[model samples]
Target: LAKTTQPISMDSYEGQEVNITCSHNNIATNDYITWYQQFPSQGPRFIIQGYKTKVTNEVASLFIPADRKSSTLSLPRVSLSDTAVYYCLVGVGTGANNLFFGTGTRLTVIP
Candidate 1:
């Protein structure tokens, strides 16, 4: 598994855009990048996943550079409810046992 690193925390105002970046220097060719968001006690929810370039969904967008060494999770127009811990994962297969998670970034959305 490739080791991942992320910011310990971040702050953003409501209605603002928030970006959380993760680094995986030793990423493998088969590895896929994934991001998850966790709110308190609830299980982490999938935000986005990609193997290269950029991918977007209704909630967030993931940007991966050509080198595939890192990825950024972009949250547009964040709200107070968006406050949570965001995790960056890397792996080759699906399912919980296949992915490896980082320490995660704590995002605080202030009204």
Candidate 2:
């Protein structure tokens, strides 16, 4: 498993764009970069995933460098309801045991 590092916390005002970056220097070839958002007392929800380059969905966008050692999750026009703990996971499969968790970044969206 690739160990990921993310910011401890972040503060953003409503209607602002927020980018949270994660670094995994020891990433593996088969590993896929995935991001999840978790509210207090709730299981993490999938935000985005990418192997390389950029991938955008309705909720967020994921940017993975060619080296695959780092990734960024971009949230456009964040609101107070978007406040949560964001997790970056690097692994081979989507199975529960395959993914490892780290201390997530807490995003506080101010009104």
Candidate 3:
């Protein structure tokens, strides 16, 4: 699995936009870049995913480079409830399987 690094903590006020970028240089070809958002005392929820280029969903947007190495997650108009940990994973065993949690970025939404 490819390793990712994100900010340990970020301070953002309510109704502000927050963008968390993840670095995964050694990502494999078969690996899909998946982003997960985890609230306090809760499991991480799937935010978005992309193999290459950009992919936008109802929750977040995933931007992947042509090299398929690193990616970025953009959250629009975040609020206090949006404060949570963001995790980036390469991929699971197969299509739609289990998730292996790793060290993720902890986002602090300041009121």
Clash totals, every prediction: 0, 0, 0
Clashing pairs in 3: none
- lDDT (Cα, tens digit) per residue for candidate 2, span 38-93: 99999999888889999999999999988888899999999999999999998885
Q: Against the unseen true structure, what C-alpha lDDT does each candidate score? A: 0.93, 0.91, 0.81
How does model 1 score by TM-score?
0.94
Question: Against the hidden reference, what TM-scores do the models get?
Answer: 0.94, 0.94, 0.87
Question: What is the lDDT ranking, best to worst?
Answer: 1, 2, 3
| Candidate 3 wrongly placed segments (more than 4 Å) | 92-100
Q: Choose the strongest candidate by lDDT.
A: 1
Residue 33 of candidate 2: its Cα lDDT?
A: 88
lDDT for model 3 comes to 0.81
